[model samples]
Target: MTAITADAIAFRAARDHLLTHRGDPAKVGASFRWPRLTQFNWALDHFDRLAREDGDAPALWIVNEGAGEQKISYARMAARSNQVANWLRGLGVRRGDRMLLMLGNEVALWETMLAAFKLGAVVIPASALLTPADLRDRIERGHVRHVVAGEAHAPKFESVAGDYTRIVVGAAQPGWTAFDASRAGSDAFTPDGPTQATDPLLLYFTSGTTSKPKLVLHTHQSYPVGHLSTMFWIGLKPGDIHMNISSPGWAKHAWSCFFAPWNAGACIFMHNVARFAAPSLLETMARCQVNTLCAPPTVWRMLIQEDLAAWRGKLALREVIGAGEPLNPEIIEQVKTSWGLTLRDGYGQTETTAIIGNAPGLPVKPGSMGLPMPGYRIALLDAEGREADEGEVCLKLDDVPGEAPGGHPGTGRPLGLMAGYEDSPERTAEVMHGGYYRTGDVAQRDAQGYYTFVGRADDVFKASDYRISPFELESALIEHAAVVEVAVVPSPDPVRLAVPKAFIILTQGSAADRTMALDVLAFARQALAPYKRVRRIEFVTELPKTISGKIRRVELRQLEISRRERGTRDAGEYFEEDFPDLKS
Candidate 1:
């Protein structure tokens, strides 16, 4: 048996405490403390220990559509990662070296991640959906020293010039090393030195919905140990089959797929489908007996479109969660009516773990993303930094000296937060100043401490002196039957300066014409308050989205601004004035 480090024991104790009190949010929040460790390597200390003890337990399960599945046990996964790590070291990969990892949901992705962790190298996760321009930007800005990508993606790097080592996971290409050759390397591995808890581990590029992608850097402890909050939020248990719907290049993938599930001894389940079909996804989940499922609001919206009740009898789901975006109350209600389970919502960013979430066994208020997770000290602060009922969501950075009112007893810096935005001190300082890390998101906290998402700070606009949250309006508009997806932005108005204008993607079989726009505008008039009502509607086939599937409202807003300057109206756009029927 391999000896465990003191750091591993401390981490295990912390993890066990959360697992033991998983159902009791208050107890876990009040008593749970992040393990203070000086030297720690999660893959070496914790995961290897779990593999040694439970060698036969399934660690990863991947099911491909129309293809056979792959199940890797804990022991085999460890040995495979060791071989990969040894091969990478032979290729001159070293600690602190930045490696750009771009691959699909194949088993190689997980193996390379573990191998990188064991080597103490920093990983820059990129989406397979990225274009050559995107890859050029990431490689140039990220200071990449090595590249590991799928054979299908090799052509993208042909135009990308860099000194980085190129390795391909599938068919071998000239000038690129074959990833399969790593299997020939020795399975036994040894580390050169101890990995500090603060050593850089992962560097993530934000989805860039509003602006350029910012490089968010995390340490060894931030993600591997920080995801304990995410584990609590998803209500994971040992031996449970956990499925998280996310792409490989994004942060949420790591939050649920890699760290959180492993932290709880749960099997990370993946269903690889070329296209997303709600019926097929639910059927697979039921057949696989997946216990915990976390998906984005987009996926939830599609899931609600399917006959959820029909699969309820076949499913073994114990908990369901929504993240990436705020979920609509109507979707929540529909799922509850069908599955008899609360679809909890959670909020976090690429810069941190699950900072705020509706944990398991907690009473979920509709549309609220729940309270602060076990280690977070969330404060809604106004523009002046004063605590407000509704303001930007910020996490307190410095520990309070004593028992501050409505605050946790002086826990130091949150273990989950990133070290800083890589190489951008100005950007990091902008968000991390004033003793708080501003999330750039706005939310309102009710008296009971439930935080409801507003919109992105910049996405929130004013119309006729009244503040309008695009999310609130979008949520209301999404309740309409004709609407499939919507993005609400302020349209230029002569009388009110600016009014809410909705760009909507209608449901299947719905016409994108004046009649449909009028109907949607009338429905919005009825669904929203007078000031918040969507005054104009534009029926569209699609909304601009990031590669990660987040709606890019910033682009729509910019388009609206340009159109207003040009004094032109988009085709299929309808104003409430055009329909006197809605002029109540």
Candidate 2:
């Protein structure tokens, strides 16, 4: 515990300094440093400290849509997690064992996460939305030794034969252990030993929009301590009610739900909805008094479709932001006009914490992902691996900001960075090559260092010798009244080598007819540069997306290539040449 005590002191100094100069980016940048840690157990050392400070203060507050609700205090959560840890240890959940956790938004989810942290076991978080087929891949590929899932999903694993222990939450199942039995365990737990900061804590399966899902590895230090930067970026403060709308499986869930809010000593607020509806979300926010809010661009886009003026001044929400996708300028402006709150944008991945974000009190530049965060040293490198104004967004793992670029990890490698891909060292080396962690997502950096999202390297295309960004065109298309959502991909063209084609989702009242296609094409033509104009359009009820809501542009591109090769005309497809006025 000596290492934990010392680690806590160092960690708090960095956290308190950020909190002290919360508004001044210059002061925060100049003073902030990642705490050097060797041995740290976040649940045992840090969370327990907060519980001691406020025995009765609310730590977790949950409200289901228009129904039952629950609140757990810091003391109660600490004690309950300790009991769960003891019970898990009794069931032979030893240190370093991988546990598959699949549950919806519930109290047990939080308790199980903390208990696993305390016990030094690795957790592989899975979305409840995952089918039995999906679960098979995780259990086999993840080398799962234990499983904690809702009772309803227990039958899914009936055919998945394995030597893993099964623990159920809701009701008694045939072979699974009931989580309720843990409540009878004593509210006391002592760890077998100190947790090394490098010990594996989380193994995440990436959403895999581009390819097969890769196993992402995070250490105890990577998330628990690393989220301090996230806390500062979100402008979280002690006792603040932070509600981030995210699913249970993804990295963003842990980024906002588990580690970031708790790192700031803020209360975790959750509103479970059977289905996400904008009007109901606003009504609940008004009733719950949520202070700081974070949601994906999809939710924000949907929320804007509601008469935002009627929902204005409903809640006490102060700091609002969007992540998981690039927040379009139109959505940000709508929220600002209605709620008088700028919906800030942040950029990170399953492999890292918030690397670049529009930190609090900073100017929100339209279409820019603010400056790099305190702990990260960002470098935009071109395809040739040379420094460029626009290229792949990379983290300087060789050094932190305010230091020379090529320093060793001891001098400063970001604590927020993941350990590596679990079983794929070759893939890890590919990303961590040249002393930088390459985020596959590309971007353009302005002179002021604000990074604007370019399409993914695979998503960017050349048409008529001019480079075009799908995100740029998609951003413009979404602004049109008839366009609810859109994905821009290259369509085959004999003249220009390739042309931008938009697959669009129409709004509720809009039709998927020729007139609507002409309207959208005309809208895009007026908004885009001559070379970047969308030449083709198609209407679809929905775009193929990962469960996490990221449009698989890769899939869309494949469909276009196949259609072109097979000479099969896609139904509901419309081209600029089809409309005489638009062609002109």
Candidate 3:
């Protein structure tokens, strides 16, 4: 009855509003503006206030192996994070300082994340799966000043030289601070000052499939506020439990698991495991009452392979979305047939939040990545920078400096765009040229405003003067019953310059022999036109992927060139000669 603080009232108001307006996009979008505060912090302004007297509100939920579960309330998390903030501050962790956080989906991960946010330190989230070399590169390039990792990871850093404090989350070691000791400090948090909206909040080292990793920087406002678009895309509401299938260290993890859902006042549910089992994951989703779900195309492909009928009847999963890459139309149709749900696909890079997405309540196009978000202005520009029906994807920037959001008249600039690639202004200039931010990906936009993702700018190739999108061919290949995963690249030919070739990974109970390859090729020919027909096929155990799980088509392309040069006999390579029954 103390005239509840502003932060508490905001939290309750926002949460209740989202609950009352669930599935009502117009109502929520019309009223939900990011809470603006000149002297505000998410931890101090919202999280701490929600924690006050909210002893029963579940804030963090973790499900470990063996079905062991742990639930922490808002009050408990607030107190624990305050202690961490105090303890970290004692170790010279100050505002704006960069800390490399490498851990699994543990409670300490969330605790330290909140504490860093409260103290206004920039966090570089690293995956626990990274090798020592990866860690060394991150430490050297990321300008990281501190590290928080598990005791098991400490030995990896022993050989890497750094001038930062080591805060181990598990057991205490010599010259290493134990995360448990944070509980001995004060529970009360006192920030040195208010956090600036433009101050750096997170730095992510992305898994570069084509080049070295780039440090993508985000501010407090960028991810936290920018994700308003992402929340809207998924149509998440307060009190809804959202489960995102992603590793802890990747940008997608922060995109869905951390910022997006939390921005919508939704609870984050994490299922920690050593490896993914589709049935077990489905069971967990059913048991946890996961309302909204998001995963990559690879996971969806695996899920579709399972007996989906066994898990489809569950009603908690109201919204199903896909990201990380385009959702093939075949997967979408399969989900619709099995579960009566449409898997919406969203598109964005590590530099931004959900810029383009198939928003909830909209009619979904099977192969398109959907329309641009509310604040986005997308353009398909030709090589000459003129608007075209199909070309490279570019975000138009405002002609005038410091213009209004989305720019004034005649000024169309990319909003929610990255500041620049850290320490590489030349590289930044390459992408951010002529007032437009080039995505380096190609796409085509129909007259109806739907955008379909073509292959990467480098992956799209010309075979006999016809432009071919490797993604399109790969998507077609994935539809085959025997194909588990596939990557399409251009193989050099004597007459046609290059031809579409597929490297396939077979599913269980399916053979990767020449017979199976021919069967898949026949299916592809029946499903696709002659122009897009896969000319050659090779079965491989695994497709090369970046650490983030994106197929490295460049690597495959180079391998194809070398194979042609050396005339290598691929494991399951099949050519027209193998099927010479057809007329020439």
Task: Report the lDDT of model 2 for residue 284.
Answer: 81
Candidates in order have lDDT scores of: 0.91, 0.88, 0.80
Candidate 2, residue 92: CA error in Å? 0.2
- What CA root-mean-square deviation does each model show from the true structure? 1.8, 2.0, 3.2
lDDT of 2 by residue, 462-574 (tens): 99989899999999999998888899999988789999999999988788998988889999999998899998999999999998889999999999989887877778899
Query: Clash number for every model?
Result: 0, 0, 5
Model 2: how far is 264 from its true place, Å? 0.7
lDDT score for residue 468 of model 3: 95
Query: Clashing residue pairs in candidate 2, if any?
Result: none
Quote each prediction's TM-score.
0.98, 0.97, 0.92
Model 1 clashing residue pairs (backbone): none
**Which lDDT tens digits does candidate 1 get at residues 228-290?**
999988999999999999989999999999999999988999999989999889889989999
Task: Mark the regions of model 1 whose C-alpha exceeds 4 Å error after superposition.
Answer: 402-410
Q: Write the per-residue lDDT of candidate 3 for residues 212-269, one digit (tens) a residue.
A: 8888887766676666678778888767788888888888898888877766656788
What value of lDDT does candidate 3 attain over all alpha carbons? 0.80
**Which regions in candidate 3 have their CA more than 4 angstroms from the true location?**
1-40, 49-55, 399-415, 582-584
Which of 2 and 3 is the better model by TM-score?
2
Error of 1 at 144 (Å): 1.2
